[model samples]
Target: MSDRIMLFLLGFFTLTLTILSISASEDAVKPNSNDPVSFLCHEGEFFIKTRRNHSEANRGRPGEWKTACENEVLELDCGEDKTVRIIDVEYGRSDGTTCHRYPHFFMSCSSSEAYHKVHQRCDNKERCTIVANTDEFGDPCPGIIKYLKVKHRCEPVEPDTLKQVVICENDSKTLKCPKGTYLMIAEAFYGRADKSTCPHPKIKDTNCSAKNVMDIVGAKCDQKEQCELTASNSWFRNPCKGTHKYLMVDYQCIVDDLGYAAACENGNMEIVCKNSSVINVVRAEYGRGHPFVCNNSPTPIKPKGCSSPNEIAIVYGRCQGKSRCVIPATNEVFGDPCKGTAKYLELDYFCGEIWDPEDSPGAPIIKDVTKSTVTFTSEKLNKTTSSEYKTQMKGADEKDWSDVLDGKAFDLGKELSIGGLDPNDQLDIRVVKKKEDLSSCIPFARFRTKS
Candidate 1:
């Protein structure tokens, strides 16, 4: 071949390869073709707090600022699958225009107890509303116009995902997850948040705290199946010289498998997974072995071992291999295993997947839902991945599945529309990642249309 022709061919192949590589990388983060839903392991990390502010608009003249009569109310909704976590709250006239009046125009101050008051009412709830009135929040600036600003985030309801580990000074403890899963630290503190943690006679300095504890522990423990942590001044560099220090850690287990669900007797229970995952029932029981579970009366079912014989088979048949399943926790379903026991249903299951931690995407959390439309958002706790999402709908009672959006694939966290539905119809909806085959695990959400 001619030298010029050889050079041209080499450059052409190199350019083609580069284009292909770029396309593949783009597809990994944002899949753009019609494909079967796939399962990605999403880290169960708590989201960063989002600020929601409510203030009174400026009215009247500049110096003659007239504050609105109505009190400012702050509302937060973290959706059905998550709970509200209050991060910070400020209530007072931070700005002049906000609830500004002639007497309080120049005052710019905030309440010292605003965070405590807001956290008491809204923390760990699905939805909350707080009023910024003198009755609720003491008038910090007296005649000054005031407003309310709350910063909070939503957290998943999976209690098993979070684990707390505490070690006294000079002691060591191991942080471990189940068989295949690894650990991810959510928070850490090397000082005393309270005096009772280590509980020593000389522990009078309860205000002692150390900074960067999370970074110190994360360097030794993140993404590991088991991590040994020691609580000592050598590692944390004691924040308070004379006070006893302890190490406290809040962590999560990153895993595609391991799930738990419970339902009161006679109530319906639902189990769901991502599109690429299937339900694998590990254990199921329908009884009040524990006094706290489904206890309607002061005392019900004292027997610890009361249970139905065929719980495993029944739950497996109903929930296995399907994206979503609902079963009633009634005597009819499991046969009166123990008569008049007032039993509840408890299920333990896992999704089958050994997924890469960095590539997994957290389940979609519904942000808003209406009669004909629903909006949801998904966050990648670690690294971002591109995956096409698809939705499927089924009537709560009827069988068979119907494709939503004409089986079209969309990006993660997009607002999806549900069309051709009758009013007051109960429905179950699930979102899955687009993949080549029909197997996955996805979270399920249920809603009813307005009549």
Candidate 2:
């Protein structure tokens, strides 16, 4: 009986020692400084840990050994238990065949209970997956929890080539060649290279020069009689004549009787003069002699035919038939008729009648005359003059006069009659006495007859 009791006590003691040894071994494997275990927390998963060195004495305790491993397990804790927790997850080393990392991270939770409750809520959902773990669930430990930030990252992107370009007016920006200097390649450009060149000079040519050009304007000429050329300088007016000659003179070439070799000078030309025997010379002055005669004289004088005073005479041949004549009828001439002439002649005739001379001795029976005591009136007379009529005869032997009836007494027989007049009528007879002296002869005479 004593042996059996001692054996049972010994067996109980061995079992209790084996259980304590197993608990201690599990506690030794809890996360500590010497053994670091890494785990991942997804986006929106709360990260939580017991405080560092939390309950340091409880680490190897009888029931605390299992709690350490339980808390150290990788889980999504969303901080529902009032425990301090990381609200964001930071990326650490990833798991599986394909894994990636994120550059930035953010916090998502603030307390322990809220952290653990969030993990419990995402327990069976496809929202998250455990990436890595240091232990199983329900372990107690303070360990590092790494996570992958599932949020997208926005970065600046670059392009392959440059953008659209445009050319502006008056833009003088030069293009830099790959091997050459900055030069004005063209007037304008659009996309890249110089597609259009300047309108003036081309691309690879030099610039234009700065010089001036000259032009000449010819003068207008008027007449065909050789124009005189004048100019400012010798370059234009040298030897001015003919086709290209410049120095011109006043002389002109003409074909006259003098034969055509610079015939006229001093700006005057006899342009229309013909080359004939009678040369037509253009006189320079006004009153120079001309070939044709021109009469420029006054009239002449003449005289009357029958009178003379201080009168001008009409010389016998000087008067034309229609020429005017003048006569002096008065002491003063009325009109000086350009001639001193009697324009007409005056004459008188007389007859006396005789009867028987014995019957009427002293007186004749009748006496008549065609004209007696005539008065001549003209422009030559101051007033007038008269003439007498008589009938008488002169004897040759004695210085006496005889009656014209006595010499021819033998004609009438019974009654003697000299003129045809009646004897019964009383007639007065007048005899014209004639003297033998020639000086005493009557200037004029008239005749009378008895009845």
Candidate 3:
């Protein structure tokens, strides 16, 4: 064996070991949403065990209670196929709480009634996250240092297709599909699209919000048969109360041998932007992945609401028909929908119906450009400082304007190229003199970047 070959082999093994070590470290830090959590539970379960103070004793007055700091939130989530079922609950200076108090509470440990409020929000769900503070759950026995200790277990369940539910306030209907099957499509009608169920309302002008219900069904009900959809504010928010209304759902289920879907496949996101000035979202399906249907539990994406890295509707909505559009898919833009889901914004858009600025009478004309302040700041500098960077139009007659990006390229039908000469560059872009205004401004800036 040659000395060179031996050295090469040693280096290769060293690189392999380093890579494995880094991978192992990442696995430890990145807690998998799908991984079962074992916290203060026996098995297939988790405990709330929340309190302002870690002690079991209660203190404080009835309406005059204060937390040590900001109230803490504890979230217990079950994986994709299971839901957290409260086995038992002993609340209000009591023992455990896995289920009910009947959704009514007075905030006083004067009785065991307040605990019911906690049960209503968490029972039989894939995930339950409640703030461990009197302010959130209400100061049940206000002044006392009370605790919300719940014992819950996850159970395997799926949406059923054999459901026939009548419409009413806060009523939910679940449709269960058989095991090893996926819901291909779901057709739901609330008031009656065909004027079948209580179409003419015996009484006069009763506002049956049929259109709104249909829109909701498209967002939450389609491709799902197992979700427990209710007539409460969560879904339709009561389409019509006074008028007669009932829900009707018809769906088709397919076998799961075909791993990912083709038409409505995994990592599929679609957004239909109307030609109207207002981006009329005709359809927006963020998650079309199987097993990971509407808001799947134990997500691997950050800021929850997302199921996969195929989200495109959000980005599409931002710059669908614009000549120039820049969008950043960050927490600030779409807020955290789910805590830990490997989510991405992917929208399937064809290059059809292009918006040509040269053809439209209302072509974009950004005029009257003056001052531009780019706030830049970071650590070491305890404050934010705005730059004196500004730009002005030199020739309005020639449609002379300027655009300074933090280095971003447009993603439209064609590459939007902007570069030329007004006098030299047609636009003057630079930073003016600094101000001695002695304010809370720092000398640093950071633009949005991908994760």
Candidate 4:
């Protein structure tokens, strides 16, 4: 009976060890073998097939959970047959805490290929939707939505000091700031604002001419608030009257009583004729002479007058009837007596010799005869004593030799009038007696006939 009890005890001990081993295996499997929360999928839904019965409790430590799920809880080699779908997305739990079970949609997927394939299909088809929970339907997946809030994109904001802002109203249209305002911010978006905001001021109506016009010395002005017209500004008036005449003296133009005439320089004077009248006078001829009155007849003649360097002379002479007139020799012939014959004869005859015959010869006779004939000859008075002298005769009829007859032989004197006899038909001759002096025994003669 004791042997039988020992064998039974061994069997009991074996059973106990087997029960412990089974319990341990059950503990390991049971901790991880809860069916993963069922994730439903539809056509084109992005999802991942959970490893069968994977549980959060099977995750070892915070970091060891990955190793625990290798090939079993976490699928490293997923076949095409096992599939899952992402029919919902839970961003936050009901208590407003971050959902730690699946921090992101990617944590629910085992394979990146499955996740990317599902996402691509859903993005193309626009059929995928996300549910916050099993009971609440959530927003569609951003990839599948036609219009999406693009992540990380922000609306532009402008500073408060910006005077103008622009906004895009549609795809092509944009709003702009008003006139008189500059763009400080340029084109940008304001949160929820539809139009552009601009800074503007109220413009007061004022005259531009009031600020432009100034005071000038000779300017003519008119009464007006705004001066835009051409006639409204300062202008120059017509200062001249009548038919205006201009005389250019220098560069300036001056107005005068005779209209517009220029001022004159040094000796120049401008004479403006008024009323169509004229002053005419002949100009005097220029020369150095006494001007005589011109004769008024058809043949004009100039009067006898002396010119610059000469004096006029006048004389009177007596005339006989077509015959030569002779005046008797008297004291009256010597220029009315008191002036004397010598002075009168000196003035008239200029030291010339004159004749006054005492009587007329029966034939041609010499008058005023100082000497009549001169004989020239050479002779030898003695063999050794030769001398020379000239002899003179009183008249042709008288043969009286002069004082030189000392038995000295005579020499001939030269005939002075070899050219022609004077109009008196007698010769007035001078004879030289010696080589030292001319002789005073010279003949002076004249002839007259009574018709």
Candidate 5:
């Protein structure tokens, strides 16, 4: 062979060998798609296991809780079909024996920020890795041994199933469910939940959040197939003054059989369901979506968008969990939203098993009353740990409830005292417990101040 031919053949053989070696190395580290360790962690499954080695990391049953000691890495896998939702986390040793290698520093200590740190890294992720150490989360106790105890669940993420959307301040967004399904809101935040959402050049505070945003948005959108929202401070009063904020809504498309009915002005609309299935009101609108519907009257419908602000609450209060409900389409029930314009009552509902009336939290009970202060207590419904209570008050003749404490939510059963009130005043007070993202308020109670 000629010298040039020999050199070319040698180079070709070396390149082929190198390519084969690289391909083999890549295949060696690729994960098995069908491996049981790659499966998801489901709801209500609690398993406490140590993370020390690869085999130990994958050893526990799929539903067990996973823990990582300091300097150790914890892996959260929700598979390809689901995402992680951190329920709670503990960054310090709650008990003396958790990571008790150092007995002297095993005193119980916990960081108040463990949940937020873990959630920021793991929530809504298909796969994530977290380091349980001071670098990840600053040492809450310098001497105490700490571990990361995380409680999480895998939520399915199918097409058009679960969604997370962020609407910037002063902007609007419409959330809609797919055909044959209704909207179920999971989480709603009117204030900033994170630093990166709704970026601003001047506003940097991300720790502020609206107290009543869940209740406000839930009353408007829950059970509806579609809803529009604007993230303006006008709607949700500024939770943090001078800081730019946004609105975030996490929702799901729930599958259910829906029924619709409409009634023109000065008419009656009766909603009825099939055998044994009660009326679960999905949505109610006391206005016109289009000018063509109920066009029998000579009066003109000025704007295409007109709706009563309290339509859903009114309809839900009257018809929720009933086998048959009869409601009138009149200004008397739902106040006239747009006066002098023709309107109609449109409702969408589902036929399903009735929701237990007792499921709702009962009315607040007056614990103590004084001239300038009134204290009250309430019981939580569904044992929801994160549920909060908002109290309101109004004069005996007043028709609206004035928000107190800037619409802030207090922990359930915590005593709240309202001060700076006139003596001998007859006031009507009410309390509402917000369960997750649902807004239905419990019944109100009446109280009188001491003279």
Candidate 6:
């Protein structure tokens, strides 16, 4: 493609994402949000606010602003006449390619995998506040003195502001305005999913074009309980057929009652399949959701000795089999990741022969086959912080194994599991303090091959 073509594409893509920021402004902030939060500031301006320094991008009324600190709630209240739109954020700092350290840079609107909870909950509204804690956003960066740096500006309230929704390809959703209100679309994009998106769609052709049909959807589904449509040509009239396409609808709902169900669910769940051949674990919830929005729920299960930090690896290590698995919502199993904040364990897995991992000679198996298990040579913790110890997976070749690690550099504990190995293989693990250094690290690991 030529430079002009690339530039045009970039412009179009930005517009598409911009629509998402506008639509579903409230739903976008709820828990389990799939949308990225990169606040769209049409009247572009850049500003920064830190614990030490404070500034505003554009001041409606110039004055000194308040300061925010850790363990405190940061409330950005734009009284009656103004609204705020966040553009970007940087929390803590970065370590190499990852930012998992404490006081980490957790939320940002500028990243491609941008965060949206801040905007969805706060933007274009009168008031919004967020707790500066790791439990709400998880430990994006662990063991770091963290501070939130936000870039945002306030705007005058628009009489004709509309809710926004950015639906991507293969994304079929039902959008409904609050009761007694009318739904309207001010912008629309129906065409190819951008380069930042899946280019060669596995389910559709590659040569796709973008299209806009906000008016069409508004005409048919407005003022109703909900509008249900798929991202296909038949639903929105493809702008370019035979090419991968997605619909971006920017809608604003006329005021009324949006009595959204505020109830949330948080609990430990177990899945069992009978007369099944194989099973595959898709997703699991072993941690707290965003306390402000969605995760497990308002009252997440909080047991004696378990929490989010280690629940995932622990659950998968125990229940990743062909048929049945049980996970308890307790601190004993997961060792409280976030104390005082309730938690839950939810798992999404598929059970079937087709979903099983492939097996080769000396590889992990998922079915009725018996094989050797993975065991550590020593039954003690590797007490050294900087030592590369090797473990072996019996009956499974090293080539057929992958690393499943919890990112603790000097793990006070370790948890690991391997794919492609026998399901019945019993792993023998021991973590003992090293002779050189008496620090205990629990880094449990296993290797398996799927067949």
Worst lDDT run of 10 residues, candidate 2, spans 210-219
lDDT of 6 at 218: 40
Which lDDT tens digits does candidate 5 get at residues 265-353?
88999887667777655446787654445655677777535677567657766776567888999999888878888988877665665
RMSD of 6: 23.4
Q: Please, what is the TM-score per model?
A: 0.27, 0.11, 0.23, 0.11, 0.30, 0.30
Stretches of candidate 6 exceeding 4 Å from the true structure: 1-67, 94-114, 160-263, 266-307, 310-451
Q: Candidate 5: which pairs clash?
A: 47-64, 47-65
Tens digits of lDDT, candidate 1, 1-451: 6866855765565466557435433322111111112222111211111111211121121221112232755667666556666665667766646544333224455654466555535545555566567555555555445777766677786866567888999999999888667666666788877877878776757777886565567646655578788998877787988788899887776653345567888899888767466665545677654443554443356553466645655775587556789999988988886675678887756664333332334444556555555555455321133335556665433334455643454454455465555444445555555562433334444455554
Which lDDT value does model 3 have at 371? 25
Per-residue lDDT of model 6, residues 350-443, tens digit only: 4443221111011112222223323122223234631443332211111211123222132223433333333332231222222312121122
Q: Each candidate: what lDDT?
A: 0.57, 0.21, 0.34, 0.20, 0.61, 0.40
Error of 6 at 2 (Å): 64
lDDT of 4: 0.20
When summed lDDT is taken over every stretch of 10 residues in candidate 1, the lowest stretch is 42-51
Count clashing residue pairs per candidate. 22, 69, 53, 5, 2, 58
TM match of model 2 to true structure: 0.11
Q: Whose TM-score is higher: candidate 1's or candidate 5's?
A: 5
Better of 1 and 2 by lDDT: 1
Q: Write the per-residue lDDT of candidate 4 for residues 280-300, one digit (tens) a residue.
A: 110111111111111112332
